[model samples]
Target: MNIDQLNTDYGIPGNLTFATGKGGFPMIHIDNGKAKALISVYSGQVLSFQPATETTDLMFLSEKAYYAEGKAIKGGIPICWPWFGPDPEGLNRPSHGFVRNRLWNVLETATTADGATKVILGLKDTEETRGIWPQTFELAIAITVSTTLTVELITRNLGNKSFPLTQAFHTYFQVGDINRVEVLGLENTQYLDKVDGGVEKTQLGAVAIANEVDRIYLNVTNELVINDPALNRRIRIKSSGSKSTVVWNPWVTICANMADLDDTDYQRFLCVETTNAATDIVEVPPDGEFRLEVIYSIE
Candidate 1:
């Protein structure tokens, strides 16, 4: 729907409104008493979020990130649905499924009892979607903006046949300096090292970025903390319905090659993802539903 139609249907006075964002994509802007956020209706992606008590945004967004259709934005909490990473069937499809680049319907909007702004966006199977992956399904993402940011991805299988699914909340967080940041959690956990030929290794201590890092920590079910000394704050991530976590930073070389990211952008953001990836895939039966939720808060 157009901005006016969307506003008439789902906008919340003094809290939520529809407007055009960068590259002319429709966006939902929210400004409740406790927090502020921006959601791109084009991709159902939360592009920006900051609580009233925080000095900076909890999420990271690159200035060079593409805002055009069919291209994924470079930051915030991107929904990598259906599958994560490369095409599981090796058909050379988009690196992370088709949903991230398609438009999502605004399902609902309201103010929660806690005074947070809640917005739900959804997408269902279509002829175009079936052309890419033959599956009848419905996907919805509910975002709550309050003193903290909460995101929930819901998937329902509408087809009779069961399907295996893997996904992630590819969240990029802003940090003052990469060198001074440490990710605490998953110490001594096994992970698949994607950058080193997919070898399995155990983490030794808090994850500190000194070079290109790409690994999917396996079997994790705990809260992870990003300690940013430069920012003088800590970002806590808690998740449910996810056993895997992906930690990645493109660093210098890969950053230079990415069109949506600046060369030095690697030093400004870190990706700590909540995922159902690697061997942690889930099977969704006909008429069954699955949920992946994550909450981010600053301390």
Candidate 2:
């Protein structure tokens, strides 16, 4: 949608503005008292969020990330829906799903009682979507930006048959130094080591960065804390309707192969995703719904 149309349709009580961003994409810019944020109208993806009290952005976006249509931006929170990771049925369509690269319609917008900007963006099944996955559905993300950032992904099943779904909020968090960062709350959890061919393994201690690491923690439903000594702060991640978490860093070798990332880009960010992957996939029946949420705050 055009910036003028967004201003007329979604602008709220606070300072909500719209403009053409990188690659000629439409974006919503918020300057409420508590925080500042930028959200892309194309993917309904949050590009940046920085509270007024914080010294740096809580979310991270890759400097070399592509900002064009049909290309997934490499940072902030990229929603992986319907199926996470590779094509579940070996269809080889897209690695994560079609939604992240598609344009989502603005369904609603409002200013909350506490002055937070709330936006609801939606995507529905079409002939285009059915070509990838044959099902009817309504997917929407409700975002609240204030002192804290909260994102809720709502999925409503409109088809008559049940469908299996796995999803994640693939969040990229900015860090002072990846080697000096630590993640807590999964000390004893068992996880699938992706780098080791998805073998089952147990986490013996709090997560620390050093080498390439990629794991999916199973049956996890608790808050996680990323302690950044270099940054002198902690990021608290809380979620609901999610039972798994993914922690990953491509590190040196893989980062060099990725076109969207710099060779050393892995040193500045960490991914701690709230997910419904592996054995935790949800089976949604006709007219059923599922919600996956994540809230971020400073500590």
- Return the top candidate by TM-score: 1
Flag regions of model 1 displaced more than 4 Å. none
* Model 2 lDDT tens row, 70-160: 9999999999998989999997878878888988898888888998989899999999899889999999999999999999999999999
lDDT score, candidate 2: 0.91
Cα lDDT tens digits for candidate 1, 175-290: 99999999998899999999999999999999999999999999997799999999999999999999999999999999999999988999999999999999999999999999
lDDT, residue 191, model 1: 97
TM-score of each: 0.99, 0.98
Judge candidate 2 at residue 48 and give its lDDT.
95
Location of the lowest summed lDDT over 10 successive residues in candidate 1: 95-104
**Alpha-carbon local distance difference test for all models:** 0.94, 0.91
